[model samples]
Target: MTKFNKIVPDDFNVPMYVNGEFFILRPLSPVYSNLDYDAVIASKEILGDIFSDNWPEGINSREDNLRYILEDYQDFQDRIGFSYIILDDEESICIGCVYIFPSLYEGSDVAIYYWFNVKFAGTYLTVKIENFIRSWVVEFWGIKKPAYPGRDIPWSEWLTRPRKKFTD
Candidate 1:
């Protein structure tokens, strides 16, 4: 089933940035059709491992890709209320990107979806991206919201691990 509603960006206009050494993320919309399509294709090429690595096969051609991006960004926009482009800061190239959307699991905070080009792996970009998203969470949802770290880790582990617990 489709994960999100398909709505235009005019309804929810809040914009935020996720900083990185090579790239920065700014809000995206259909108006930036050419740029957004280029970024999406570049992202698919760079972070294909995580982004399009497992995408259903046989989706060839630009038309197929455009349809996919339309649905993909639309779902993200509907779910997260925003989307952003992955831009290279130095040369101003579009390397790859990430997306934030409503959490699927109950009792969880917002969902943070990150996919960066392989060239960006093992860089300060990861930490900066994490910190940026953390700041966004704090600003939009408040620090009191509980975030599940995922996996089979126990609630005790999460509560006792580093950083303050949501509920004492």
Candidate 2:
């Protein structure tokens, strides 16, 4: 299968950071382990629903969360995927995360997923982030079609859909 990086232009330069009215997006790293871990545990339930999977369940310590962020950093550095930790405007708190990568399901050029802390569960900030991501992927990555698996497609239906394949 063709990889996402293969489709990206050699000169493509993704944004190092993105700023929004309510939040900021920065690449995931171990530096924010304490803040990230606390946020994850605080919003584990909302995250479970957003991802439609059990995760962070096994994350019992800051070390566990650090490992997770390390993987995200590795994937990003390797150009396999991109994961960013969402932080409030002041940049002190970790509110959520966003993942952008090749689509696992058919009919989309890319897949994007995001979630906020439970406190922002139903706030306008959720709408702001969702809108920002939808447009950001298209403009930044030149994605013609972006799939929001959990938000746009029900997880059950999304899981049963055909997996995307790319040929060289």
The prediction achieving the highest TM-score against the true structure is 2
Tens-digit per-residue lDDT, 56-163, candidate 1 = 232455565557567656655454334566666752555444555544445544445555545555578766765666676567545344353322334445435443
**Candidate 2, which ten residues in sequence have the lowest lDDT sum?**
1-10
Candidate 1, residue 103: Cα displacement in angstroms equals 1.7
- TM-score, each model? 0.56, 0.89
TM-score (C-alpha, index-matched) for candidate 2: 0.89
Residue-by-residue lDDT tens digits, candidate 2, 1-168: 455443366577866788887899999888778888988999987677788668768788999999988987887877667888889998898878888877877887777888787877778887888788888888877889888888888899989988766555
Residue-level lDDT for 49 in candidate 2: 74
Least accurate stretch of 10 residues (summed lDDT) in model 1? Answer: 159-168
Model 2 pairs whose backbones collide = none
Query: Alpha carbon lDDT of residue 138, candidate 1?
Result: 65
